[model samples]
Target: MFESIKNLFKKEEVFPCIIFDGKIMKYLDLTQKQIDKLQEENKDWTITKKEEC
Candidate 1:
């Protein structure tokens, strides 16, 4: 019962990626903090989150 309830509240997984100069670089796993840091470091680049379903 608890397992099912926990599953209901589970968050979907996402993969982070960096797009720069028409190039896309995907990461296996990246936290929000890491993504923010990367964005800060590369102002010209773009950081995106892709849901893994």
Candidate 2:
């Protein structure tokens, strides 16, 4: 039952996000401009990297 429900939303890939100061504020679906802005704001830490298997 649970397996069937999980399979319904299965995806080939997942985009990771960043959690800081008790907030989730990063995503891979951002546009290039948004990414640049984020990079400028959070220069101290690197962005999450995607994994391929």
Candidate 3:
């Protein structure tokens, strides 16, 4: 069962990082639209580092 789960996970693609300001945040998988939305909503907020989801 554990091996099957591991195999399922292995089939997925992962993104290494999301860089905001000068910081790097790791994320497994995130859509471009989601990221764009976050950036748009947080435009007025000060973010010095990236966020991972």
Candidate 4:
């Protein structure tokens, strides 16, 4: 019971990404698999991992 309660408060790790398709979109939290699929589908769009500063 306590373990489940603790787990509820825990935040999942996020891999932030940005996609440039003639516009600026920031703080896009996505998994590597999703990013790969997006890149594969959108060849013209530029996608990059966001660096934590």
Q: How much lDDT does each candidate structure score?
A: 0.65, 0.54, 0.49, 0.80
1-53 per-residue lDDT for model 1 (tens digits): 99999999987655555445347655546676677787888887766666532
Error of 1 at 11 (Å): 13
* Evaluation by TM-score, superior candidate among 1 and 2: 1
Q: Pairs clashing in candidate 4? A: none
Give the Å error, residue 29, model 4: 0.2
Model 4 per-residue lDDT tens digits across residues 1-53: 99999999987666788788867665688877788898999898888887743
Which 10 consecutive residues of model 4 have the lowest summed lDDT? 18-27
Residue-pair clashes per prediction, in order, are 0, 0, 0, 0
Worst 10 residues of 1 by lDDT: 13-22
Runs in model 4 deviating more than 4 A are 1-13, 24-26
Instruction: Report the CA-based lDDT of candidate 1 relative to the real structure.
Output: 0.65
Cα deviation in Å at residue 49, candidate 1?
0.2
The candidate 3 region of ten consecutive residues with least summed lDDT is 44-53
Name model 3 segments beyond 4 Å from true. 1-16, 19-28, 44-53
TM-scores, each model vs. reference: 0.47, 0.36, 0.32, 0.60
Q: Sort all candidates by TM-score, best to worst.
A: 4, 1, 2, 3
lDDT by residue (1-53, candidate 2, tens digit) is 99999999875443454424234544465444555676788776555534321
Error of 3 at 20 (Å): 4.2
Q: Candidate 1 clashing pairs?
A: none
